[model samples]
Target: MTSPHDDPPRRPPVISSPRRAAVSAAAVTAVLVLACAALASAGGPADRRDPTADPAPEAVATSAPLDVAADRLTDQTGLAVTIDALSPAALEPGNRLRLSGQVTNVGRGSWRDAQVYLDIAYDPVTTKGALDDANSSDEPFGTRIVEFGLFDRIGAVPPGTTTSYRLDVPYAELPLSGAAGVHRVGVTVLVTNRDGERVEAARADTVMPLVAASDPTPPPAEVVIVVPVTAPIARHQSGNFLDERIAGAISAGGRLRNLVDLIEAVPPDTLEIVVDPALLDAVQDMSDGYAVTTRQEEADQGSGRNGTGQVEAEEWLADFQTVTARQNLLLMAWGSPDASALASQRMPGVVAAAVRASDEFAVDSGLITPTVSWQKNGASTRRGLVVSRIAGAVIQFVAADNLVNLRAQGESAYLPSLVTVPTEEGELTGVVTARELAGQRLTMSTSVLDFRQNLMAEATIRSLEAASAPSPMVVALPFGWNPGDAAEVDVATAFDLATVEPVDLKAVTQSTPAAYPGPIRLTPAQSPLSDELTDAIVRLRTNGNTFTSLLTDNADAAAFDRRLAVSATSLWLGQPQERLALIRMESRAAAEQLRKVTVTGPTFVALSSRSGRFPLTITNGLQESVTLRVDVRAQNPALRIDPIAELVLEPGQSRDIEVTTRSDSSGLTPVRVRLSTVDGKVFGAPWEFDVRATQIGVAIWVVMGAGSVILVGTVAFRLVRRIRTEGLHPREEPNP
Candidate 1:
């Protein structure tokens, strides 16, 4: 038997010679003859058997007992071990590695005399691929450190109970005598089974990157850490917050607060923060004492309770401004909308509007205008790139894995940070972020130490793999990323390692872009916005434009556009129903505003002559001045009405419009009156009234009188003629 400290066995050497080849042939021939003789003695009807027949039952049963026994041994214990804390994340010569965590009896059975030991793989992981596999793998690596007084022992662990454990072992006791690099470190629990066999009950593994003093250190690699300072969308279109979550988020020990604290801890030039203008705008409003509508009904009714985050908002904003003043900042489009979904749905107008609004906000608030566009959730498409180009973005940030061509090149260990993406509008610089490192920032299952060590290991491996000439790499945090308070320090430490040199994002973008393969490849969006939601957004924007035309002031129109942009944010992706509901709410609010300007008139009117004038009341109920035109028409052909000219109304002002009407005949005629904006969009429902012409015209009277006079004269003439011809009485007596 070999000792665990000994190196793994090596393969034997092969010999190639004519004499050995002849001896091997003779041995093979003799073995074949012996096998044929043995088979003939034990077989029955071998010629009739099919070549594809299954093995015999006895042959299959040979391994079944071993599998059953192994399974039975595994089910004997119910222990679960976890590593909560590790001291000295990096191991050095003569230094001790200490770890502490809890072990719980999750299974039904209890474990007696359970012992916890540290398992270290003496063989260091040399390649980046092997390191990644070790980080994600579950199987234990290396031999257990079974030395006395180097492990923790628990007498008994009953069901549904938990126990604490701590293991401390000196570096010398560990069988680690190889090149310094990342190694697989794990904790295993050994329990006795019913068969008196000590089997592994449970195990937990993590990465341990060893940096010894004797090992040669390489030059640091350039890395760009892009941190996102954003929040989920929660504001209503009417400038009221939908909830008070932002208050907690910016308060002490909150997620946003932790980010600010983290930035303060690190060097100002080492980090790049991507800020969402909408988030800052909301916080500014909160600092000014805003209102929050807790329920949808309350929002629809225009009622809300006063928020209580003025102090927190003020503090956070002040700190944010102070830190960002000395640091590099990149502004995202307003609300950080889902540009990919918009492009896929064929809505570039929304993207353009969002970009414009973000620029305006940045200028007004004394912040940097955004020149780079980032895809939400690190997803991108060809059309998405075009939209970004049209939105005035010079650079586009996308996940590395999304580029199929780059992945197919099989150079993931060290890919250039920048690539040129061709679009219809123009070419854009595409910034590729490390997919694995970016994803690791969002994992919460591992301990902070594990997370920090894994990050260091990944960076170290990259540096080692590209030792010849290391290219710049970008590690962009996921959208809405919130690293907890405890992990903030750990994350900072990970970047401060000797193997990594944090650089500003601008440095990476300024470098020459690598040439990408032809025929760009992009992965389909996993959670794209539905077609119905995008169509509704388009309709909502169209209606918003029409509604804004009623206002004479351009500022109010711009404010409404910002609200529309907020509603189309990426926060709504994969949430079609919720987004549709928000669109409906916004539509109703706009309709309510349009209803403020209306036309009211009398239902019935009397006209003393063929031509007359009546009063139609026009009111502007909005808080701002409006310029509109009044249109009136007669429903009957016998009636004619003159059009009213454009008029301006002040806030809460009412005016009576005099409408002129004329009729050819003396009768009642129906007239309809409507109000429209200067842009020719109808404001509200039409008002109808009946106009009765009471008096006839002088021409009609003259014609009637002349006709009567002629009739009388004719009658008189007829009577005189009848008398001359014969007596009128005689002619009447002959009628039968």
Candidate 2:
């Protein structure tokens, strides 16, 4: 979290139109007038002239000239400053002097009014001779100084306006008696703005030609200058674009009822979220460390370093955007920003976006916010104007997370691996061939044995070339290629390729809406029944959630999605038995048999089983004659259930059904299998299953045998002892 103190004072983006520019210019003019008025009344920083104490004052000869007019003053800001203008000056050996100038605003906004200070220095002629393009100017000798400031108010003057100020220094204040062999004199100004932004401006004069006396009192050559960077004041009226957009949202419908409600209420918008650099840095420091892509390695690969730089940039930007968007929704949901600020109204939107972005971006590559800082380099009125641009933005994409990472990984080596595949004779052509052999047989696989093993005995065998041979066909093998191996020839199919095209570098579009991570089926307006169901959808969206979490212990997730289909099952459903929720869920279900789905990850679906039994409970509540028919379907072809058929039950009849499932060779994981119902809701009991090996009656048998052997052995032993020793067990022997 960024502290209020950490915020970089910001100037809103330049929304300069002809009219606006004129308005801004007029505003600047007004600011200058105000600055002059403030200066006259304030007496220019009382702190600079604390007369009464400090050891005492020294008297000097009237013949001596004053070295400087003003001594010390301070202004802080971030804008970079250059000398724009200066006042004329004359200097005599022992005379005092004054200097004045203006600092212009160069950054985005105005700095709240602040004072500017001067640094006076003296350098010997020899020292000046040593100065070069790279060297800093040195202080000259015998300079007296005083301090003064202008434009000290709550806000900065608008950019393009010049705020002028002056300072007076008397020569007697100088420590030097007057060493003179022609020393160079220089003055530099430092201004600090309200936001702690700093700007440095300087001017030097090395042409002061003077001759020193044989008995000379040497001047002090050291000068110290400290500039403060102040934060810029944030200013706005109620009619900004942001205000209008938010107002529109409020007019449509104030606060969103929930996450789904919010989505339904608004279309997607391009958002830029700004975060405190300091807070972000702290978060990054505490976060799980990022993957490091070395500079040397990237260079070797002919690519940019910081493999996740762009990824992190995008994610941080996106998360910020999402959070802000939710904030807007909260404002709408609660009817006003003030209302949304209340915990009750804020929580739902905050939590929802957190949960959504967290779950969505978890598996994402380089999804982290990084810290940044701003340097004040220019001036706005007396304030420092500072700004930095976002690194850059990628074209908006539906699967942006995946698409971005993939792009970063470089063009898919697997792309060319698709389309035309080399075969024994030639290449397989067209989508028909591609689809037929999609997962049927590895088109790139050269191993005849494995190919024949998985294929049906009567399966069609089409060689790349026409063949008249009886059993097998042969052709020239490409040199340097392994003869019989299934290689991933192409990762993309023609259908997949059709979805994307190359984008020009300079032509990249901004804010292209990315399909909000599987928005087609699991939309913002919809919610899953179970946390498990939610996990399943998230897994579908991000490929991050585990399938194990989605399944009912021993059952398949797809099977659960099917058998457990009802209003009570969706995670989005309100508290169990909520009247409004129940009705809404039922209506949604009735409107759609199976939601349309388009998966963008791996195309195959698969399933696995552990051990647990889902207790199935059938309750017959209605008094009228009724019948129920349940049909199950798995989304993935590889998923299957035993006895895949309709389950029928007559009125007043109830039965428990245990359906088992496993994945076939296709490896297509079942996202969900739907169980259609004809009448009455099916309430599924929690499934349970023994995970270890099934023992059956073995434990009972083992115990019974052990008991019988112990009894028989004890009796026999007692009888033998009784027989051996006449004193024993006539009872025991007789019983035996």
User: Against the hidden reference, what TM-scores do the models get?
Assistant: 0.72, 0.18
Would you list the C-alpha lDDT of every candidate in the order shown? 0.67, 0.25
- lDDT per residue for candidate 2 within 160-250, as digits (tens), equals 4555544445544433324333222333333455556654322222222222331332222110001111111110111011112111111
Residue 352, model 1, lDDT: 79
**Per-prediction CA RMSD (Å):** 15.9, 31.5
The local lDDT score (0 to 100) that residue 565 gets in candidate 1 is: 68
Q: Write the per-residue lDDT of candidate 1 for residues 37-118, one digit (tens) a residue.
A: 4455677223344657743211100101111112222234545566666666667677789887666664557677677778
* Model 2 spans > 4 angstroms off: 1-616, 619-736
Clashes of 2: 95
